[model samples]
Target chain A: MAAKQNQENLPVVLVYRRPQFNLPHRNRLSRHFILLDPADSQEPTSSFLSTYAQSVRALLCVGYSTITSETLSLLPSLELIVACSAGVDHIDLQECHRRGIAITNASVAFAEDVADLAVGLLIDVLRKISGADRFVRGGLWPVMGDYPLGSKLGGKRVGIVGFGSIGSEVAKRLVAFGCSIAYNSRRRKPSVPFPYHANVRGLAADSDILILCCALTEETHHMINEGVMTSLGKEGVIINVGRGSLIDEKELVQFLVQGKIGGAGLDVFENEPDVPKELFSLDNVVLSPHRAVFTPESLEALIDLTSANLKAFFSNKPLKSLVEIEL
Target chain B: MAAKQNQENLPVVLVYRRPQFNLPHRNRLSRHFILLDPADSQEPTSSFLSTYAQSVRALLCVGYSTITSETLSLLPSLELIVACSAGVDHIDLQECHRRGIAITNASVAFAEDVADLAVGLLIDVLRKISGADRFVRGGLWPVMGDYPLGSKLGGKRVGIVGFGSIGSEVAKRLVAFGCSIAYNSRRRKPSVPFPYHANVRGLAADSDILILCCALTEETHHMINEGVMTSLGKEGVIINVGRGSLIDEKELVQFLVQGKIGGAGLDVFENEPDVPKELFSLDNVVLSPHRAVFTPESLEALIDLTSANLKAFFSNKPLKSLVEIEL
Candidate 1:
């Protein structure tokens, strides 16, 4: 009954300040509901949120932006936290659950493009596509003789770290290329035909390539550490299209430097927009600017999904792409 | 009868002088026949062959090295020419046919890797994998904002320019990626499941991507010219894994500059080792030195196939990968 009264008074959406690279979400969002962005005010974010504490029913979180318990406590009337990215690690999930506030994310939104990127990075690292391009672009092809031979994609034992929507899409594409598929997920999917290893180490030990496509949580943070990379071995490669924190970046860099791991195709980094300078010079490592989610077609899809999720939440309809907070 | 006598005595295999980058074929070839390499001799190539012309019945023509009528005339005793590469454009086929010299090539050996490269390039160009990799490595992500979005590959209309072994392999791999396959072959392949376009322009008109995998012949020379590129429209991508002569390079460059065509993934350039300076700066294009056939595993496969073909010819058995000269 109190919730009904809150809806009667025009529902308010509190939005975080836009990241440097974010696409404009306000103009489209303003067409539906009243948006209360903190950046619009000259006052500090905490101060602005505190002023509208009783009215803000939902918060729209941007990529990699934090929502700590202290911040959550400031918005006592908050009900839903809408994340604009697939990885919700930046959000305090425990606090959301404890407060009984529901959380939603861009899961179905970025799945296809991220999967496409995961496959692209894997193929690039395996075939030396980017390295060869640099060779030709540098005028080295004409003067420096032939580029070295690259490994084949067919017959490779590819182990996916997360067997979710994106990982499955990646497996589907690689399967067409004749790669043997295996995986390590939080829980074994009985219907999935690919071999499942219970742990990342076991998956790495059995895999020729380890692809990270899982979400980041307490159990999965730094899951691909030295021991996992060691199990992956000298001939094995790592492809990360998932969140950067999923792998221990320091260990991966050290292993890449020592040639303990064969190669890597990384889209995300531990401190994104700030990759290690050491990786810049490596021929085998293919670096992407955290853009697995930035394809134009993907961006269009995201805008539609974002709008739908927002509208559904405001009208109190069933939410779109509502992520299970625990899983 | 004479062939039997020549086989009884160790058969003479004449090898052409290799360019700087070719692998050493002597140690491996020595097991089956007496190798008569021109580079081993201090005398002129003509003079060296003249001394053992009668004994040198088999000629192993190294990659794209011309076997002109003049060279063939000098080796009057030569009856078989084993080409070490797939395309026999450099070899004067009319003269070889007039002389009744049988030929075998590395088509079967390099088909899979070449097909693998074609798919890799297609994915690279469409997804901007290499371009995005360059953006990250340049440290542009921290300040330069989001990289541009790329197109998806799953639903693109891919037209193969040939339907031979390599072409068919490319089709199989692409079909797995959910691409709609079509073809433009000299004759309709009744057995092929893909739709057939009678000419290059028609194929381009219907295709979102064009994959050049045909042999470069008199009929196919400069096949993908201005007309074809124009027909392909501004959104089409071209992947050339075949010889560079298949496309008119100037027209391609002009089209790319004007955005008449979307992008290209070129492994073979018209004047290799001399790619257009303009191409070096284009983010959309993915350039590779003519290396689709040179993977270490493919090289090992080629060595085996070469050995088998040589042994088969000497033993008077049917040849493997023997080209249908007229077809």
Candidate 2:
């Protein structure tokens, strides 16, 4: 077929394992790029990458697939790392910086959905949506008469932990809900109107709610701890849509159990796929597995942006979503 | 005995039966007016109302107590019915109109919280916040790997069914989250920016989401029927923050079961304290126990508003929250 011939002529792209979803647009990616999978080759993964992907100029990293320095070395001809995920912590940024390999993340494509989730979580925690859902599902409504009242989101002093693309989007949404917004970031965002706190503890001290949307880095690891939780006080809520390590997970669970803080709506956990079982029964907390970026609209947008970035790379045009590696 | 003596000097006010929860504000209401309750007297309920509430000029209606013609007949001197609730469905609007009695609902005090819940429910259903929270809590994440992707709220064509105070508030909040808004009101709102559809069926046909915030009048009852749900199609979500009867509950359950519609986030059911057991197991539908107006903030605001309205009534000035019972 002419299409098969065209596929053979297209540039080889080493696509990491497919995302575990029914991605309708992912199938269309082949029309633009000849996607090759190491898992599909008869040979083992490392050898397959060395043989077939050695001359591959671009690699499309899907989900949280690790791209190590050793793996980068294998793809000596690789010019670009197109991440199909918002967070690039799994990819070795330092190695890419050393090699001068270009990195394009899915931030622009996924920012709205992630921000949507962050606001959703904040509302859920404050309104007890998940808890109320559980109570209704348990057939307790008829007997219980009325579900417990939840706190209002309006006029709450909200502190955004990262005022990045995702955090900023969250502030935009919550502002319409009448929440007063503030933030704590690596640097004060001059373009933003919110008061910037340099420290998470200070942010918590001033905020009735804290929404975490920063990147996971060594310096920012375990940024939300017992002291910060205590500072947030008995009525403060924390909504984390960023990586799990952004908070002290054990301490958060302990604080939630001990009632040091109001509640939480957690999309990610420190030991993911292994959430603390203690949270299972808590009416105040809403626990969701790390799924902030998991939306059909976001995923489709990711496919489009990633394909454009690859097309731009092959054509030597300005790349889309290129992240300046702060090495 | 000074407090008891002060109560004798205060103006008489007939307080309706208490809500299920402890009313911390009810104790303080005595500081403004001499509170009268049928339950407080040793006489029977009807006898107490006839004896103690006969001369009461202002009555504080709490919870869903029915102000029947008979009950109103007992308080012939009653001039104002200050409801501590937004919906006056339980109150005899026709009877009050015929008797030329004034009524004031908690629309102003509870609009923000109800709107907050509507937006929260929309986000929860579209993003599967409640379902994902359930998946994580059930310890199924490790086994399930990832929850199914939910639709994005951004850019979705949201058709608001009723465009009153709560609907306007919901639209204001959702616009910031990137939802394209439309509405179906009894009459076109000249002040609104969104497109206006004359009928709900047409609105549903054009919308990815439908948010019901209209009052439950005789004509407005069961507004969301099978035709509307079918027009919304397989990807459309319905969010009800208004009274339960606004939707045909039986048809909604059938549609969800057949996958004819996308999902629903129900804050109020057709029957109070009773939801369809069929909806209990559906993953797409998010069930809430009629608590959209039950936030602590709204409750406090209601207390303040009710107190103010009662104060205004006794002083013979214009009342706050005066419902102009459209006769």
Candidate 3:
């Protein structure tokens, strides 16, 4: 570990408020490396970054932390900056590139985990397994109610928006369920197995299942608007495992209320941890607190992969998944 | 269709309540088969027995409705009786055999469906998908406490009892999730992919996930008693899709409360439709109202297969699954 760290001094840095990762490990990082934590100062131990900035390079950070052009001017050794999480809106990527410092991100790492969760959420919601548990637990068994029987995954049409790594992985699992796949990307990839549509409304019109797998890019923000919901057939089910900002929560609630779509499985919301209160009375939606990447297997894979990337970076090797920042 | 039924005059009358013969075209069979709408009648339709009884070589049935000796005596032409469901306790197999009758059952038909539900139930239970949905529907989100994070199915050790068709199917799916499989049957089948044990205690001792997939017979009743529970390790999970009689519900509840076993996913209950209210408060367990084989795909398969059997029977061919009642 020591030999790898000393091989080359990693100058640029970015960090996020993630559940894992600890301080003793952070302290062991090279003092010459720029450090940034996206989480607001919720933990007293996170304040160690201010004192360590003297020998730092450049910062692409989040939350209460800031990286001004003045701070950029102070660090003569500063070269590049990157955000650790998917959203770069939190980081001043433009300013970093304006100062000739490259910017990057850790977006693709979560693709598979999020995609897996999307499929799982879709299955759970459609099957009504959770409601059955609630019914049994409530001691309301044999009460003779209209329990919903579920449909098979086989022979269903699934539409995915944003044909990125996560979208592709989700496509793979759905294939195993016997579903016919389709997707819509900013620009169509001719190599994809499923039919790629030109627009979100086209995908919605064709799909029985609509999946939001796109990132929270500006043009993509709130892309799941009222029009798209109307296009998705009345029996269609939507699953969102992407950025909360990508969906129009109000529109979703309205659609759910009117039964515009059969059901929805959401891991993210417009304002998460503060989901729209109006969404609570609808029996057609399944909700998760934006947690698709937290599975133990995925977590272990994520840490090991990220650790490998860091180790490689410190060893003067080309970094993996280098996010391109426009200068 | 009428002419075909007359030509195929089934020698042994196998009565499966809600046989789903019309699932493919539910609306189509409104006039053909002697449909026994359990909702409309507490007793088997008189026309059902009378139409097929005169030439009825045997009586094949299930436990949904009472089948008394008098009912059996009514069919003087009865020579054999087979049950389509797994359990024979509901049928007076003794009286049938005493009357020199034979029997058979589609014992393994529901295995695949049950196994599918078992996995679904476990995932839903552990992930608290239903609870999240309820929270979202009840307008409690966006002002919420904690969003439930689900566990992954991969890397768990699955223990199966009665290593039969359903148990084997469960093992197959669990293996896909990267789980190590172990099972106990009356005797192990060497060709199976999983490791087999001689007793339930051995299976429980090593498994992280213990499942009940055995038939409900005298020898297997209450097999998952206190000793079996103790052997299943403290962190183990149990899923029962076999029979209610196999588990002691009171003991299971106690063990769950005491944290002896991690959780349970139950489809059948000792006294179903009357599940304990205490079960609902705990977040660990998932419950289904014995509706595992109620999926559209399975329902279609059941109807198609049963219709095929009926067709074959009237054609003077032997039945597909013949159980030896006289043996």
- Report, for candidate 3, the interface RMSD: 2.8
Using Cα atoms, each model's DockQ against the true complex is 0.61, 0.82, 0.44
Question: For model 1, what is the error of residue B57's alpha carbon versus the real structure, in angstroms, after optimal superposition?
Answer: 4.2
TM-score of each: 0.89, 0.94, 0.81
Candidate 2 lDDT tens digits, B122-229: 888888889998898889999978787788888899999888778889999989988899999888989999999999999999999999988778878898998899
lDDT of 3 by residue, B215-270 (tens): 77767889999998999867778888888889878899999988888888888888
lDDT of 2 at A206: 96
RMSD of 3: 5.2
Report the number of the highest-TM-score candidate. 2
Error of 2 at A314 (Å): 3.4
Docking class of 1: medium
Residue pair clashes in candidate 2: none
lDDT of 1 by residue, A163-207 (tens): 987888888888877789999988899989999899989999999
Off by over 4 Å in 2: A1-12, A18-27, B1-10, B18-24
lDDT score for residue B200 of model 2: 93
